[model samples]
Structures are given as C-alpha cells and as structure tokens.
Target: MVLLKNYISLRDQAEIVRICHILGVGPGGLQRPGYSTGHKLQLHRTCFGRNWNQETKCQERYNRDGSIPPLVPPELVSLIVTSVQDARSHVNSHDELPLMSPDTALVNFYTATGRLGLHQDRDESPYSIRRGLPVVSFSIGDTSEFLFGHSRDEDKLKNVLLESGDILIFGGRSRLIFHGVRTIFPNSAPPSLLQKLKLKPGRLNLTFRQF
Candidate 1:
C-alpha cells in the first residue's frame, strides 16, 4: 500500500466536493444484483463507465432495465491517473506501473456513525484483476480508522488513520486484502473544508477503479 498524506490541496478538495454536489448524493440502496435489501450503505454513489454489478463482479453498459448514464468525467480520470503514476514511480523505481485508467468511481458519504464492512475490491475484469491494477482512493472530510487484514480475523487486522486529503493505493500482492472503516471521527473535518463544500458533518471517500 502507498499512502500519500495531504496529497490534495484544500482548493482541489473543494472543487471535488462541488462537483459531487452538482452530480448528486443519495442513500444508494441495493440497486446492484445479489445484495440483500437493507444491506447497502447509507452513502451516495456517482458511477462512471459501465455501472458495476456487485453480484456478477462485472461492468455492464446498461442496468437490468437497459438504462445508461455518462461515464466518469474524462478530466477527473486523468487527474487521478496522473497522480497514481507519479506515486507509483516514486515508490517502485525498478517496476513499471501499468497504464491505469479509471472506468468507475464510488463516492461514499459516511456520517459520524457510518462504517464500511470488511471487503475486497474484486469487481474488475479478469485481465485487470490478473494484473492487479491498483485502486486509487481519496479521502475528504472527517478522519477515519481504516482496518485491513489478510483474512477476516479481527485479531489480525492492522489499523491506520485516514485523514482528509489523504490518498491510498493498494494493489499487487496486497490488492485482495480485506479492509473496511472502523470509525469516523466526529467533528474532525477542517472548518474550511466543510464550509467550502457546504457539507454536513461526515466523511467523503472517492475510490477510483479500472472495473
């Protein structure tokens, strides 16, 4: 895992929040197949590329009803891809980084009590999964206690504090690690960040993947 602290500036963070607000936020219910009702997170999701199917672990251009929306904005994809390459280059000079392009994004809004269950990001295509393409995640707003483990055993988990403007990249051997948020620190977001974004007390995480 490559953790970049304070990687995004306040100005950029504000812009991202603004865009998300314009796009929309919600209580993204169990819209994907195989997910039981009420098993979904109380967060919003703005998808890009073909929508991801949690059940099939694949991307489809249309939903079961045959509807399609625009893919993630090109500018946003480029911004993240550039940052990932830069970080990868600095961390492993001998290894060549894959040409990463984000085809999907999950923008999650977590209130003070919201937390994600331990899960692996294994929804990408077979080729990308085989290559172990990294998932680039951006954190904004309140801090979170992120937990990760090779297995589901809680005793084996390692914890990390993910603060606002932090970026996390995990792939290769560590790509399939089980990870989730343990807690979100209440009222921990920077005043400027909340005010500029006009968001209530909560944390916002944008995770970009190759799908």
Candidate 2:
C-alpha cells in the first residue's frame, strides 16, 4: 500500500513507452491464456530469467522451448528493483525487505471501459511466497480506480486513484491482498504523453514480480 506519486518523470515515461514498442506490446507480442477471452484488458508479458504460462498459470526458469520470449533488459529490471528497495528502506530501517530480483512482468492495457477483477498474485514459487517478495507496479497513460481489500469481500474494498507516473509497492503484511482495477478515466492521460507515445485513450500498467 505504499504509493510514490509521480515517481517517474515524463521523459522516463516516454522512454518506457518506446521500449515497450520495441519489445512489442500487443496481441501478437505476448499471448495470454485462451481462457482469458472474456477478460476486458489486453496484456503483453515478458520475463527476465523465468517465464510464466498463462494457460497453465505456472512459472519456470526459461528454456529453449520457444513458448516465451527472453527476459526484459537488465537495466529496466534494475531501475524498478532499486527504486522499490530504496523507498522501503527510507520508511523503516528494520522492515526486513526480501532480496528481490524480479523475473517477470505483466503489461496490461485498459481502455476506458476495461476493468480487472479482484485477485491475488499467488502464482510465484513456494520459495518466493515464503520470502514474501513485493510486487512493484507502475502506471502510465489514463488514471484508474484501483480497488484493494484485505479479504475477498468487495464491500470492504478501499479505493485509490492511480495516475500516470505513479508507482505502487505492496508487500510484507500487505502482500497477497485482493486487488483489481475497478475502472479507467477516459482522457485522463497527459496530452504530451499521448502524443509522444502515439497512443490512444487508455492506461498502461507494468507490474513486476519474482518467481
């Protein structure tokens, strides 16, 4: 539940968009599970050292199976991991943050009408779960109404507005909390950002996790 507002600058945001374009971030780029046909959001995924299978919903160290692409650039991974660790250290000196080296990323695109249902990120390996690694999430483009609840009760959900350039880090006691994107605000993106990235009205989210 730790939020860093405007954590990334406009220049950095545009750079990330460029990188995503180079890496590919559409239907043909990363294939989601066939069962996700009914889902509203579109997703593009990339792995660092490990790859996740949406169909089987499992993660494994990458191999030459040709099913998944290679890991994201090391520089990008370092930027995210370093930022989260530094932020956590500033909050509590003895917070016992896990030594996190993110190996997977889920890039999700949401239109004004797109929404993500409440869910927990519990697919990491047992070792990762035991260590309680944090999930680092970044937002670009439109703003979103993010819902998070301690349990599965929708009535107890707390709402938060996630704007472009915002970063969210949840772990430790807050890890595994039920969370989802309730809705997206149309035309909420920075005009310069949309033009620079040549994007339509939508939000792009990048979540980093360890496996």
Candidate 3:
C-alpha cells in the first residue's frame, strides 16, 4: 500500500467535487448502500460507469432507481492513470504494479460520525483480483483516520491520517489488505476548499477500479 499526501491539486479537487455534486442530485445519485440483511453502511454512495449493488454483491449497469449510472468522466480517468504512475514512481515498484484502466468508480461521502469496519475489497472478478488490479482512492473534505493491516486483528493494525487531496493505492502483494475508516475529524477540512466547494462537515472519497 502507498499513500500519496496532497497528491491532487486544489483546482482539480474543486472540479472533481463539482462533478460529484452535479451527479448526486439526480435519480441515481448518492444514497446509502445497504446489505441484503437490511444493514445500512455509514456512508452515502453513488457510482460512475457501473453501480455496485450492495445487496447482490455485484456490479450492475442500472441503479436502484432504474437509472443508468453516470459514466466515468474522462478527466477522472486521466487522473487515475497519472495517479497510478506517480504511485509506482514513488515506491519504485513499476514492475509490481499492474496498469489499471478503471471502468467503475465508487464515490462515497461520510458524515463526521461515519465509520466503516475492517474489510477487504474482494467482490471484483477473480481474474482481476489475481492480476492485482489496484484500487485508486481519492480523499477530499475532512481528514479521516484510516486503519489498515494484513490481518483482522485490530490491536495490530496501523493507523494513518488521510487528509484532503490524498491518494491511497494498494495492489499486487498488498491488493487485498484489510482496511477501514475509523473516524472523521470534524472542522478539519482546508478553509479554502470548504469556501470553494461549500461541502458539508464530512469526508468525500472516491475509489476507482476495473470491476
């Protein structure tokens, strides 16, 4: 796993947030995802290019409202490409990191009290998992306490602060590492970003994958 601090520029951050806001007001917009057992997650989510149905535990082209999901914007795709390159460059692990062409993106918003339990993103195709297709994550809005470890043992996990504009990527040997968000620090967003985007007191995260 690699974490790039302040990887996204302020202008790009605003643009991405703007795009999310536009898509989120529509029929297939941001809504809380729940499991088949009727347990709702702590975040609001929407998808681009493909919708991940939490109940079915699979990807769907149409959302719960019977609307096609918004396509993954070209600009965001370019950003993911560059982010992967930069991440590989940072760790000098180009050979270990496979090239990624993200066709689906999960855009999630977390309130101040929101928290996700430790879990692995293992729902993608087995071939994708075997090839180590990376999950490129972008963070904006408030800072969050990110917990990640190889095992589910909480006491042995390591914690890091994921601030706005941070990009975290994990692939290859680290692709299926257990991870979760512990908490959000209220009023921790950059003043400039808050003023420009007028986002709520929470965290905005977008994770891209090939699906």
Each prediction's number of clashing residue pairs? 2, 1, 0
- lDDT scores of the candidates, listed in order: 0.75, 0.74, 0.89
Q: Can you write out model 1's per-residue Cα lDDT over 40-93, one digit (the tens) per residue?
A: 665545455556555544455434445553567776787688778767865664
lDDT of 2: 0.74
Relative to the unseen true structure, what is the C-alpha lDDT of residue 101 in candidate 3, on a scale of 0 to 100? 94
Model 3 stretches with alpha carbons more than 4 Å out: none
What are the runs in model 2 whose C-alpha is more than 4 Å off? 25-33, 36-54, 59-65
Using TM-score as the measure, which candidate wins? 3
- Comparing 1 and 3 by TM-score, which wins? 3
TM-score between candidate 1 and the true structure: 0.86
Q: Distance from true position, residue 190, model 1, in Å?
A: 1.0
Which segments of model 1 are wrong by more than 4 Å? 25-34, 56-66, 93-97
For residue 73, model 2's alpha carbon misses the true position, in angstroms, by 1.7
Candidate 2 has what TM-score? 0.85
Instruction: Write the residue-wise lDDT of candidate 2 on 1-211 in tens digits.
Output: 5788888889989887777666554323533323546642344344444555555665554322444555766866877877776667645643545557887877677778877878898888787777778888989999999999899897798999999999888877677889999889999998989888887688888888887
Q: Which consecutive 10 residues in model 2 have the weakest lDDT in total?
A: 25-34
